[model samples]
Target chain A: MFLIVGIFIIIGLGFNLLGAFSLYRFPDVYTRLHGATKCTTFGTLFTMFAVVAYSLGRLVSTGEARFAVFIIHGAVAALVLLITNATGAHAIARAAHRSGTLPARAVVDRLEEKEEAKGGTPR
Target chain B: MTIYIFLFAAALVGLLAVAVLGRLVAGPTIADRAVALDTMNTLVVGLMMILAAVYDSVVMVDIAIVYAGLSFVGTMFIARFIEGEV
Candidate 1:
């Protein structure tokens, strides 16, 4: 049980570090957001999983209903993290583009064209 | 002994958060800093969960839930400001 906990945490930490390093190394804001958001979200998934496992293990060993609260709450927190991270990423991406943070290798810009066609002025 | 390991892992995450802070400080654009700050908030929740496990406290996990929600609001507000929607 404890070993599973350790493995999840170590994996989570690795992903977490990768995202942070990618933020520093990525060439531009959009690319950095891509790297940071994906890696960190995945990393948070594992860390939260570790918490779930810990709570379950405690429940099994201690045979108490109190530990069940940890299980449910930890799972809920993970679900909340997953949902909010995606929404926040989209919000950031849209805001970045609107604020004129263009990608480096700009070959296609269908969204910009579509937005302009809608007569929405860039603020 | 197991709790100590969890403590060590949480401490390691805290150190990583500090390292990521360098990016927040050095990010060239507001968006870059915002992205880094958002990632750091996610990591803070992870840290809080690890501590909850170490301390064997259900309330800490509940706190993590609230923390996640508050941070999400903060990130959205920053994104809204960056979009010039404010």
Candidate 2:
């Protein structure tokens, strides 16, 4: 049980590193959004899993009710992360693009150009 | 044994937080910074959960849940502000 929890934590760490690395390495806001959303979600999932596994193992080891609280609360936290992070990332990316921050390497900007062709600004 | 795992997770989260900070700095627009801020909120919640396990405290877990909900509200409010509807 301990070993399993340890492995989850390690995986979570790796995810965190990837997310953070992308944040630093990406050249633009769009790329940064890509990294921050995916990496953070993956890392957060692993960490939450570790917490759940640890609590369950402790529950079995010591036979306590409080472990249940950990499992439930941890699960809720994970769900919140899933729900909020992806949507928020999308909103930010859209807002960035809408506001005229183009990608560093882009061949076609259908969204922006289309909005312009329609005789109005990209709202 | 268990505490070590939580500690490792915390360290990783800290690293990730640094990455998000980089985005906040390099973000070309306010919206990009908002994205990083949102990601940070989730990371903080995860960190709190790990802390709860490390300390063997259910109270910490409860606090994490509350924090998650509140952050969601805060993120939405910020998003609204960014959209210029606020």
Q: Judged by TM-score, which candidate is best?
A: 1
In model 2, where do residues sit more than 4 Å from their true spots?
A: none
TM-score of 2: 0.90
Error of 1 at B50 (Å): 0.3
**Which pairs of residues have clashing backbones in candidate 2?**
none
Best by lDDT: 1
In the range A1-123, model 2's lDDT, one tens digit per residue, is 878987888888787777767766777878777887898788879988988998898889899888887788788878877887777777777667666678888888788778889887644
Of the candidates shown, which would achieve the greatest DockQ relative to the real structure? 1
Model 2 misses residue A36 by how many Å? 0.4
Runs of candidate 1 exceeding 4 Å displacement = A115-123
